[model samples]
Target: MTNINTEVVLRKLLDNIAKEHNYNDPNVSVRAITTDGASYSSMLYAATISTPNKEELQLFAKVANVGEIARSQLLLPLFDIERFAYKELLPAYEKIQDRNKLSNKDRLVWPKFYGCNPNLYEETVVLENLKTKGYVAYDRLKSIDWAYASKAVESLAKFHALSIAYGEENPTQYAELLAKMKFNPDSLNKMAGTFDKLVDMAVAVTKEDNKERLRQYILKESGFKNIDKFYQSTGLIILSHGDYKPSNLMHKTNKDGSIDVIPVDYQTISANSPIKDLYYLIFTGSDEEFRRHHYEQLIDHYYQQLCRALRNLNLDPEKHYPKKNYEKDLKDFMPFGLVLGVLALPVITVEAENAPSLQDENGLNSILTTKTSNLYPERLNGIVNDYVRWGIL
Candidate 1:
C-alpha cells in the first residue's frame, strides 16, 4: 500500500476507535500509531489514546479490510470470524461458565475484549495493549523450550474446552455459532502457486531419497482430500485456533521463570478436530528431541487439563471425551499438519529482512520469495519422515 492510503486507513481506524470508546469526542485523539508483523494482512496499530485532561490509555487496534486482490486470495471475510469469536462465541461460552459458577482461573485463555466493528467492509477490533504489561513473542527462529511449549499447549486446552462446555450446555446456540464460521474448502486453490514455490524450496533443501516422497505428498489429493471435513471434525469437534504458531502467541516471563502464555490471532479460527491445533503447535514449534522424547507427555498434559476443564463445567470427562478418543484423534489428524507444515515453515523461519511486506499488491509474491532458514527444510523433513513412518505417506 502507498503511504497516503496507509495513513487514510489508519485514520479511519482511529475514527472507529474514538466513536466506540470515546463517543466520537474531538477531545480524544491518538498520540502515535505503529505497525508490526500483522501489518501484512491486518492493520495493527499501537498508540496512546489522548484525552483533554491529559490522561491517556494505551491500546492496540487490529483492522482488516480486503482489497480486490486480497478478497480473491484469502477468500473468507476474516474480520467477521474474529468479531464473532470475540463478540458472540466467547461471550456465550463465558455465560455458560458463569451459570456453572466457574471462577476466573477456570476460564482463562483469551484476552480482554474491548470493542469491535464487524462492518463487513471495514473492520476494526480494539484491545487492551498487553505490550504495555511486558508481553512479547518468543524469537520466531528459536524453538520453544519445554517450559514455553508446555504453557502454550496449556492455553490451547483451555480454549478447546470452552467450546465443548458451550456445546454441551446449549446445543442449539452452539450449532448456530458454528454455522457462522465460514470456510471454503477450495480456498486452498489460491495458495497453489505459493505452495508450489514452497515445495520447490523444500525439495531443494531435502536429502535426495526424501525429495520424491515430498513431491508426492504435495501432489497427492489424499493428503488434503478430506481437509475441510477434518477441519470440521464431525464427531469430536472443538474450536481450533486456525493458525496456532509461536508468532501468534504472546508470553511474559514471570519472577519464578515460568511464562504466562496468552493466545492471540483469532482471524483464522475454525471449528475442527482439536488435534489440528496440537499438530501445528508441536510440529512447527518443537524440535526433534522434544517430539521424540516428550511428545506423549505433552499430549497427556493437554488432555489432563482438558478433562479438568470439563469437570469444572459439570461434565464427566470419561463420558463426554474419553482419553482413548483423544489418542486416536491425535494420530488420525496428523496428516493435516503435513500440509499445514509446508505452508507454515517458510513464514515461521523467515527473517525480518527476507520476510514479505504483506501490505502491497506484490505482497503475496514477496512471501513466495522470502528466504527460508535451515530449519525450514529440517522441519519439512521431519513432517515428511513422520508421515511415512506412520504409513500416512
Candidate 2:
C-alpha cells in the first residue's frame, strides 16, 4: 500500500526479528490487515515468522502512508514520537519498574516492541500481534460501556504513573523527550479554522435549545483559547497519550470475566496534564448516558489507580499531585471534553462508507468536512446539553 516497497524494508525488519529470536533461516509471510476507516496515516500488515524449530512469532507492522498530500497534512513528528515511545520511552519505563521491583500486575501494559525503522517514506513500527493474543479493537462507532471503560482507564493511569516515575528517575532524559514531543502549534492554528467550521456545522444540526449556547460558547475566541491552553499548560505536567480512544486501544475478555486492555497507538503522545488523557478518553469514547452514570466514579477511579501506581513507584501521590489540586484541574479543564467532542464527533460518527478517503489529497480537511451519520447530532447535543446544564456553556 502506498508503494512502501515492503519486500525491501519489511523483509529486512523481519529478518532482524528472526535473528533476535535466535532463529536460523526462518520463513516469513505477510498479509494486509485491513480495517475500514482505521487509520489515515499508516497501513497495517500482519507478518508471521516461522523458525525451523517449529516456533512462530506473529508480528504487526504499521507502515507510513507516504502520499505527498497525506504526508504534508498529518504531523510528521507524530511518527517520530511513536518510534521514540516504543524504542526508547517504554524500555526506560521498564528499567524504572525493574529497579522498583514492581510486580507484573502493577506494571504498565503494552505490546512488546520488536523494532522500528524511521526512514521518511518507509517509516515502520513492528510489534507483537495483539490479535494473536486474543485482543480485538472495540468498534469505533459504539460507545464504550462501564466494564470496558474501567479496564481502559486503569491502564491509562498506570501509563501516566510510569511517566511520572520515569521523569523523577531521569529528569534530564525526560526533559529531552518532552522537547522532542512538543508539537508545532502552527498545526493547531491551521486546524483552528477547521474547528470553527466544524462547530458551525454542529450548531446547524444540533437541537434548537443547544444551538445558541453551543455556538456562543465555542465560536468565540475564548473557547479556542481554552483548547490552546490545554496544549500549552505548564502545571501538573505528565506524559499524555494524546489520542486515548477506543479505536486506538485493544481489549480482550479473559477467563475470569476480567477485561484486558492495552493502548496500541502512540502517534500523539505528548507532555500535558494527566486529565487531558482522562477527559479525552471519556468524552471521545463514551456517550452521554455512560457519562451520566460513570463520569464522577471514573474520575475517582483514575485518581485512585494513579495513586496506587505512584506508590508502587515509591513516589507519594500527595507530594506529586494532591487530591485537591486534581479536583481544581478537573474543573479548570472541563471545557476540553466539549471542545474535543464537537471537533471529533463528526469524524468519529461518520459511517464507514462515508468516511473520508485516504486517497484524497486534501487529507485532514477531507476528514473535517466528511459526511457524518445521524448519530453525530445526537452525540453533539448530548455533550452540549451536559455543558449547558453544568452552566459552563
Candidate 3:
C-alpha cells in the first residue's frame, strides 16, 4: 500500500496541467488528502502555485481514484459525472440563468468550475477555492442557527428546481443521464449494517425504558427495507445530493449577520428523489419542536422557492412540478427521513470525544466527515421526540 505511487502520478498530472494553464513555476504542495470510507478509492489533494506575490491567486486540486470499489457506491462515483455534468449539463443551466430561474440572486449556486480531467483509472476536478473568502464548513449538530437553516433551505430549492426543469424540458437528456446513474443496493445494505450498530450504541447509552423503545422501533421498521419501497414505487428520482447534511454545507456571514450556504462534496450526486435531500437535512439538523413548528412552513418555503426558480428558467412549475405530485412524493419519502433520523441522530449528536471518530473504521466519519459537533444527543433527542410527537415514528 505504501508503495502506491499516487503522489508521483498526481504531481506529474498537475505539472502538465499547470504548464498548459500558463501557471508560473507552479510548485504544488499537498495540503490534505483522505478517503471517505469504504477503502478502495482515495481523494487526493494538493495546492498549486503558492507564492508571496501571487498569494491572492490560489489553486486547489482534487483527484478521485476509483480502484476497486463497487460501481454502485453513491457519492464517490459522482466525481466521474462531475466532469460530464460540468461540460454538458452545466452549460444548459447557465444559458437559462436569470433572477426568476434561481432562488439566490448571487449566482453562486454551483461551484465555479475551473477544469476536469477524467481518465479510465482516476478523475481530477479543479474548482474555485472558497476558503480564501472566509467560508467555513457548518455542521448543524455542532453549531447551527436559524440563519444557516434558512439559507440552506433556499439553496436546496434552487438546486431541485434546476433539475426538475432540466428533466421536464430535456426529457431525452434526463432519461439518458438517469440511465447512467445506478443505485447500489449492496452499498446501501452495508450502510444499513452501520445504522444497526449505531442503534445498538444509542440503546447502550440510554435508560432501559428508552433503550427498549428505541430498540423496538428499529427492529420493527428502520433500515434499507423501508427505503426500498419508495425506490420500487414511484422511483421519484432526480439529481440528489446522496449525502446531504450540515458538514457538507459551507457557509459565510453577511454584514447584517445573514448566512449564505454553499454545498460541497458533489461526489455522491446521483439520480434519486428530491425528498432524499429534504429528509436527510431535516433529520440530521433540526429537532422535534423545530419540525413541529416549522415542518410545513419549511416544506412550503422549499416548494415555493423551487417553483419560483423553475419559473425563472421559463418553465411552468404548475405543469412540470404540480402540487399534487410534490405532496405524493413528500408523503412517500417522509418515512425515509424519519427512519434515517432515528438511525443518524445518536451518532450525529454526540460530543466529539464521546462520538465515534471519522478515522474509526465503523464511525460516522467513515461515511461523511463533518467537523461540527452541533448534532449532539440533546439536539438529537429533541429531533427524535419531535418525530414521536408528529406520529412519524
**What are the Cα lDDT values of the candidates?**
0.71, 0.83, 0.62
Model 1 C-alpha lDDT versus the unseen true structure: 0.71
Clashing pairs in 2: none
Model 3 per-residue lDDT tens digits across residues 151-256: 7877787777777767877899889877676564555665666566656555655444355666676666655466555443364577877667786787888898
Candidate ranking (lDDT, best to worst): 2, 1, 3
* Among all candidates shown, the one with the greatest TM-score: 2
What TM-score does model 3 achieve against the real structure?
0.79
RMSD of each: 3.2, 2.1, 4.6
**Candidate 3: where are CA atoms >4 Å away?**
1-10, 27-30, 33-46, 50-56, 64-78, 98-108, 117-123, 182-195, 206-208, 230-236, 342-376
**Which of 1 and 3 is ahead in lDDT?**
1
